[model samples]
Target: MAVTCCSVCAIQQLVSPYSAELSNGMQMAFLFALFTSAFCREAAKECRRRKKEYIKCLESRVAVLEVQNKKLIEELETLKDICSSKTD
Candidate 1:
């Protein structure tokens, strides 16, 4: 990776500063390096994006579970009341 980075930097210098034109292959390598670097920078943001999505999903699930639990508790209390009245 370091070697590739160094080579890319060298190629960039050659193309930009030294007024030396690169061959088609070298130009392609340089463009690939630039794109790879850009993607690497965006990769961290992508990770954060996925994390946020996962957290949102978890929170929504939790909310749904909480509501379901409340409904179940209410049903259980109603059953208890009915059972007590039957005994009376």
Candidate 2:
């Protein structure tokens, strides 16, 4: 009857209005709504956790690619110098 969370309180208010008429049906519906709310809360937390891990993986890959790109650029410059010396 006394719900602390604003969201849950709102749900209870919505359900309470119909409680007298619905009786057992209202109780079942309220329980189902609560279960769904808790499940969604947990699912959202899990999604955030997975998103953070994916971002970390992408950052690591970007760092590795940057290092490899620098090495390739240096090698290209070295080859250019060698070619110019042979031509001279």
Most TM-score-accurate candidate: 2
> Residues 1-88, candidate 1, lDDT per residue (tens digit)?
2436876676566567533566778777877777678668678788999999999999999999999999999999999999999999
Worst 10 residues of 1 by lDDT: 11-20
lDDT of 2 by residue, 29-84 (tens): 87678868877887899999999999999999999999999999999999999999
Model 2 TM-score, all chains together: 0.74
What C-alpha RMSD separates each model from the true structure?
7.3, 5.4
Total backbone clashes of candidate 2, pairs 3 or more residues apart or in separate chains: 0
Q: List runs of model 1 lying over 4 Å from the truth.
A: 1-15, 18-37
Task: Give the Å error, residue 29, model 2.
Answer: 0.8
TM-score of each: 0.59, 0.74
